[model samples]
Target: MDQYSVPAGPAAGEFRDRSSKFVAALYHVQDEAAALDAVAEQARIHNRCNHHCYAYRLGPGPDRWRANDDGEPSGTAGKPILGQIDKAGLSDILIVVSRYFGGTKLGTSGLINAYREAARLALEEVTVTQQLLLTGVRLAFGYALMTPVMSALSQLGLEMADQAFGERAEVLLELPESTASATVRELQAAIAGVYVEEVGDDFEVEGLTVLVTPTGD
Candidate 1:
């Protein structure tokens, strides 16, 4: 998948059933590690709560994800939270629902509805945004080819993440995955003596490190 939906930022939701309070907190996370960290932090914040259930989806396909029921019954908390996330077609996000029991027990269906509703409410409060998968590219070329290389990238509507000027010129680019290959080919055809290679998004260009952020089209 080239793009997917995610929460623009953090949001909170609340649900009450039979005096029990369910607080849902949503966060935008890039990977599983961040997602887990969010969950852990929520647990610490709501240390008095009885349960800290959570669900997270990551990446384009979002196949790498998990749901935790915490101390709640199997599938009572986590599954419903995950269901709400999938219903919204969202990824790279985490939702944790902390429950404060009020001397009452909610059955299986009651737990599911409470969790689902909490998650839904949290999602409703968030502004959904799209995340585009991008490919990082490093270009090295001679001074003579700098103008053409830069002009080619500009014509393609691509922006440089980082650039360095020395004996040779080096530039870092983050291209949309859909057009990365085509953009590279166009640059090669337009400029001579230019070296181009695909790199990971985290790859840093020494001497001139710049942050490359993914933007939706």
Candidate 2:
């Protein structure tokens, strides 16, 4: 995919129903590791909360997603949060709803509604941006081709994520998947058609941070 939607940055919102408080937090995450970190950070800040339910959709597509109710009823908290994310047409994001039990049980449907609404509240406040679907590629070429390859990459506005120079030059790059073939063709033509190996299908792209909800609000 050349482009897809993602949150611009971290967002927060709260909803109260029948005294129960649901604080929804949404973050722009590049991978599952980042998602976990975001959740851990929330847990630290809101220690002793009733529950920390979360759902994440990572990458340009929907296949890389997971939901966890975190002790909430099955399909109650996490699924609803995920549903709201899908409804908003967002990806590469993690949305967590922390519950502070308000001395009254919300039951199944009420809990789902509260979590879903809280997530939507955060989504509404955050900015959305379209980003490229990145793909990792590794290229190794003879030392003689270094200058030309570097020149070509620079001219194409591509940056190497990692680079190694020895008897041979090896560089790892992340480029838009939609343009990978064309990029490879251009680079190969520049260096006289050398082999370029695709590293894997781990798409992680940089994201800009925008304030969705102010801290301590």
Error of 2 at 18 (Å): 1.2
TM-score of each model, in listed order: 0.84, 0.71
User: What would the per-residue lDDT of candidate 2 be over residues 1-217, giving only the tens digit for each residue?
Assistant: 5688888888899999998889988999988999999999888878879689999998765589999999899999999999999999998999988888889888999988999999999999999998765666677767666677778788778898788777766787777766765676666554543334431233211221111111110
lDDT of 2 at 13: 91
Each model's lDDT: 0.82, 0.79
Off by over 4 Å in 2: 135-175, 186-217
Error of 2 at 215 (Å): 33
Write candidate 1's Cα lDDT for 112-150 as tens digits.
999999999999999999887887777776676667777
All candidates: CA RMSD (Å): 5.9, 9.9
Residue 105 error for model 1, in Å? Answer: 1.3
Query: What is the model-wide C-alpha lDDT for candidate 1?
Result: 0.82
User: How much is the lDDT of residue 136 in candidate 1?
Assistant: 76
